[model samples]
Target chain A: MRNRQQGRVIVGFLAAPVILYTVFVASPYVQAFYIALTDWRGLSAEVEVIGLANFAELSGDPVFWKALLNNLVLLVTLPVVTIGVALFLAFMLNAAGGPRSGEIRGVRGAGFYRVVYFFPYILSIAIIGVLWTNIYNPINGLLNGALRAVGLGGIQPSWLGDEKLAFWAVLAVLVWNGVGFYVVLFTAGIKAIPASMLEAAVLDGASRSQIFFRITIPLIWENIRTATVYLGIAALDAFAVVQIMTGGGPNDSTQVGSFYLYQNAFSYGRFGYASAMGVVLFVVTLALSAFTLRATRKERIEF
Target chain B: MTTATHDRVSPQAAAVGPRRSRSARAGSSGPTIVVAQAFLVLWAVVSTVPLLWAVISSFKSDPEIVADPWSLPKALRWENFARAWDAASIGTYFGNTVLVVGGGVALTLLLSAMAAYVFARFDFRLKGALYYFFVAGMTFPVFMALVPLFFVVQNLGLGNSLPGLVLVYTAYSLPFSMFFLVAFFRTLPGEIAEAATLDGCGEVAIFFKIMLPMARPGLISVGIFNFIGQWNQYLIPLVLVSDDSKFVLSQGLANLAVEQGYAGDRSGLFAGLTIAMVPILVVYALLQGRIQAGMTAGALK
Candidate 1:
């Protein structure tokens, strides 16, 4: 009797979340997969099932390929640049230490710098997009203004206008907005490293460069891997920047899979096609995350 | 390991070249560090310049903003904030956002915490399978679900409603919130709960009186994260809500910005943008320490 009652309680406890998850998350996912194999245009009740036809269509879609390639480009570019710069900044801040660290003549304003760097992160992407739209404005914008100031007036370029430059410009905004979080993460990771380890190395007369590459980097490998996976997933999931800034324009040059999916579902009402794209994106993200986990998994060093 | 080699050679180099290259080394090394600092500072300035410009422009006349986009306002136009708030019906949106975020967060915390506790404390069959099932939800990009989700909501007659938005947000945030809480609840001492059980305390009793209080920090952290995510949510609400009265702050701001273009009499829009950013900034500042600690907790472990 007691065992049965205990079992009942456990079942009751698990029921709510499980049901919610099943209904909202799992059910929708299953429905998405089903819709991917159909000809539903999101409005009419009438629909036709076409097994793998949407996938076949996607195979030939040039915009699909472009968006996929843009996502791939973002995946490659963002992680290295954002994480590298963040790690460097974290190391510099860590090396500087506390009050005395900021009191040093050149580093006197480190606290102010940290806040300024992190400020962009708090703003919504809509704001960031709008802000950058003006900054990249061909007429009376900062980029053009600076070019003129530097005597490169003739080289003033339309940043978001040209197809080749649009993607890179968008990528820059992402990196700028994202770097602060990684900086905070890396800084905390660096702080968690024992001071004794560094002291011992210094006592042994180790050069600064030797200590960093051999000791510090190895210790923070987990953070580096985490940051990489995060940025990779972020690149895959990016939408707001592309949506607001270019609306995946310049002839779909800036289109990413998410933005493309949005356009298909909302603008074109091609729900079935968008659902197929969503499935592809899901598979790609899952594969990338698994690959990252596998690559980063090794002997865990207990410090 | 390489420090031994460095030590062995350092004395010889110092003895042989004490004064020969001191000035040159200083000149070269000093400039390098200076250049690096300069670059970092420049990056920081560029990142913040737009926000500063926005805040200042919120106070300026339309002509002034057009004249010098980067310059400070000649006079503060505080009425822009009030005007924008009234014009955009931000009051209604604000109320709806609060309802959705508050209800969603509360439901998420209750459901996820209870579920996490069971997973953490009980050794049930299919536990690993269930845990992995929840984790899989995290792996799926939400954009994929947008179409079907809209259908589901509409089918259930929840379209264009605040409750529908809350329900969707709860579903979306559940995976991570549960994941965090599970990791957290597992860290609690099992013996305490066993003792309560031995004393004939029911599972609900112990959960309410003991585990819930103990899990306060984790719950707070998860709640804060959910609040931020749901508060700033744009995509879900944008799709789920067609009625202006149901819009969240983010969607409202986006609509206003798009309607008025980036440069159009944007003093009011800037004020709206600043107003939208203020609540989040204040909350983040107030809970910055706890939020940062919570974020790093899992990694450090």
Candidate 2:
């Protein structure tokens, strides 16, 4: 029989974490709602409550809108570009290795290839931001230097400085940093499919692309779905990237919601307004995650 | 067996024959395999080259780097690293990062594992709601809550301190740490606990002496994950801890880049970047497989 001591143990085990989690993580979340209504300059004292003014002002603020639009762009582009390329590379690494049960196994150096693909995932995003900053340097960077060497200097542009191209430049670095992770991820997922299934599809006269779309894609839907949600969440909060890379960029073309929220609270001392934006960011993240889970939800095909 | 004989002959064919007969390698199309190989190679190069440049550029003089960003260093300007480590105070930042990340990871794992054990094994009335409460922590952006969190941390009178950063790190890390760990605890068979309990071992003993030991792999993986995440944390420390001497590595690196403009020594900048990156890179290189397994275990689930 479950006794009083056991109940005491359960409470003790759960108490600290639950309380700490609530105090540190959950309380801030709930507190943000209340604090959003107040005009606090990051201090506890001398704060007056302002009802919906921050939200009202936020609705018309163009910088907040620009940041939201940039996040929208990342949400749309980063996932599609990253997932598409990851699927291809994963298939190329895993499926194109011919038959597992046949004479040969996976692709040659498959392990090595995976390590290479996964290398970028370990680096800090801030580090990635710094590395790309140097690479995108107009005068002495690798990109423009290589472009000039190819004798097509006319097309070379100041990557981070060009207003027309700054957003795309940031997105390019994000894609480059992100694609390798998904490639390794989908590779693991694709590798789990029984080889006989794929070999049968091949013997049945199915082409590579056909087998990919019909068989492999459906099988790895779970991974794709999870990856999509994570990527979408990441896209919604492009704080470290934008903060390090361009600091919201030339003319605010690449300011994301999280970074904007940060700048308002820390830089401009506008806690109330920032909390309003924070609320919106939270809602968008919630909606984005919900949308991904729903959009990618399908009948799970057990192997 | 024809298959066996074909296997024997295939390697020789793959090695000796040109690209025209390279299908013997994997039975895929010749040019397709070649193209795919080329594409993957290209991608790998793209991924590695930036880091490589960062490392190599660390050793070069600024003029040499500017002259040929692609070329190898002519002078082994070890001064750059020295200047960055001492002059730019990267060494101090690195030590600070070590302390905070270490504290954060240890506390996060302890709190998460304890909470996860309850969520995994217990069936209390609010268990479902409480677990979902932590799970929902995964979705909300941490910075979105920063405005209020600032007030909370400031009001607690723990501003600009390493311990405060550690507490914040542990708190924010709870959600994912708990989520990842609850799955691990669930996978562990319950019969052992039942047996231990039946033998008169108490609940705490059963968990500590029985279940916690079994959850080591999960703990290690989660530890490494939380360590990396806490180390890379920029926004939290950037906003909360403003003291220059107490800055974490990422925050310090940002200071070097954004605040001081790398003190006008480009090579020192690369040196600081290299110093910041190398330790993690080494650990990652050693435990690449394990890290990936632990980090992506959820995707598979």
Candidate 3:
């Protein structure tokens, strides 16, 4: 009787969240999947169930492919560079030690460096896009100005205007803004390593390089894995930055999947087609997440 | 001969030890130190340049901004801030942002924490499945549900309202928030709650008095994260809210920037961007240590 009573209390505690989740999160997904099969124009009394027509349209939609490609590019570039650079910088920060070392003169500025590096991550993407737009402005922007300063005025090119460089340019801004968070993640990971391990490494005649690669790097695999999965999800869900900066423009070279989905649903009012695309994105994200979890699953190393 | 073998081993160790020390000492000394300093300084400058450029450009006249975008402001145009504020109706937008973000954070923490507590404290049939059910919600991309969510909001007659946005934001953030909080709550000792129960407290009271206070750090961490997420939310508001009066800072700023045009006075745009960024920056600056400490705690676990 007491055990049953305890179970009831637990169920009562869980009821609100489960109901809320079902209503808000899970229900919408089922609804979206249903809507994808119909000719729903976002608002209308009459709705037609067109079967796989929406998915059919998606298969041929040029913009959809463009957006998918953009997402792919983001997935490729962001996770590797952001996580790698962050881990590298974190390793550097950890090795430098606190200011008491005084061996590295710049170590005093570590706190300031951390804050400054993280500053951009806090700002809205709209601001980041606007800031970068000015930086990339062909005529009077900073990049062109620097080029002029360096006597390379003739090579000044339109950053957002050029089809080839526009995506890469926007990506640079995304990368610059994103690295700080993972840096913090990896820094925390690095700091948690036991001092005794390093002392033992020293005692074993291991050089600094060998210690870093073999010991520190191997130890922080979990952090690296977490950072990778985060960056992957972020890449898949990227919308604000592209939407704000290019609006997926310059001949749609910068069109990302999420932005495209937004455009379809809200701008073009192709609700059904957008729903199909959304489902595709959802599946891809799920698969990637599953893959990450599987790949990163390993026996935890005890220190 | 045995002594000779010992001497051989000892001498090998002795010979390698000083060389290692010498290199270690040199490695910790001047040249590498200079290199590390140079690298950090370069990275710092690279990171700060865009922000500095934005701030400085905001102070320049329109013509000057266009003519010399990278130069020091010839004169500080403090009026740009006021102009942008008025033009964008930033005051209204700021209020709306506070309402949505604030409500969203509160609701998220309240609901997710309760759920997290239940998941942590109670075990029942399909408990693992129930927990994973919530975890699965994290994988559902926001864009996927945008269409139905829009319809759901419209059907409920809550579209374009602060309450509507709050509902959507809360729903969206719940999965991750719950995930983090569950881990945190699970780490809490069950003995406290058990003791509270033994003291004749009800489950609700035990949660409120004991578990809630214990989960403060986790709640704060999740709260700050949700605050940032909701504050910076763009697409949800874009789809759900059509009224300019109800626009959040992101949409408001974007409209202001577009209206101002690329050639349009960037001073006002930059000023507006700066205004948009201030609250987030302030929150970050205020809670940075907590944020770092919380993240470290969460990750290192």
TM for every model, in the order presented, reads: 0.89, 0.93, 0.89
Q: Ignoring the other chain, what TM-score does chain B have in each prediction? A: 0.86, 0.88, 0.85
- lDDT, candidate 2, A1-303, per-residue tens: 576776787799889888877877888999888878988785545788989988999999999999999999899998999999889988888876533222224566778877877767777887778778888988888898788788877877988888889899988888887887898789788878888888777656576688789999999999999888888988888788788888897999888888888888888888888888888888888887887799789999999
DockQ of each two-chain model: 0.33, 0.46, 0.35
Clash counts for the predictions, in order: 0, 0, 0
Query: What is candidate 2's lDDT per residue for B1-301, written digit by digit as tens?
Result: 2355455446644663443232233344444555666677778888788888899999999889788777899878999999999999999999999999999999999888988998888877788788789877766878878877877788888789999999999988988888888989999999999998879888988888889899999999899888777888888998888899999898888778764453557888899999988898888889988877876775666
For candidate 3, lDDT tens digit of each residue in B1-301?
A: 2354344334434444545443445434334444555667677787888787777777888888777666788778889889878865777888899999989999889989988888777777898888788877876677789888888889889998999998888888888888888899989998888887788777888888889998998898888777777888887898889999999988888777788884476788888877887667877888887766654454455
Tell me what TM-score chain B of candidate 2 gets against the true chain B: 0.88
TM-score of 1: 0.89
Model 3: residues with Cα > 4 Å off, grouped in runs:
A1-15, A96-106, A203-207, A293-300, B1-21, B24-30, B295-301
Pairs of colliding residues, candidate 2: none
User: Highest DockQ, which number?
Assistant: 2
Ranking by TM-score: 2, 3, 1
Model 1: CA > 4 A from native: A96-116, A140-156, A295-299, B1-36, B296-301
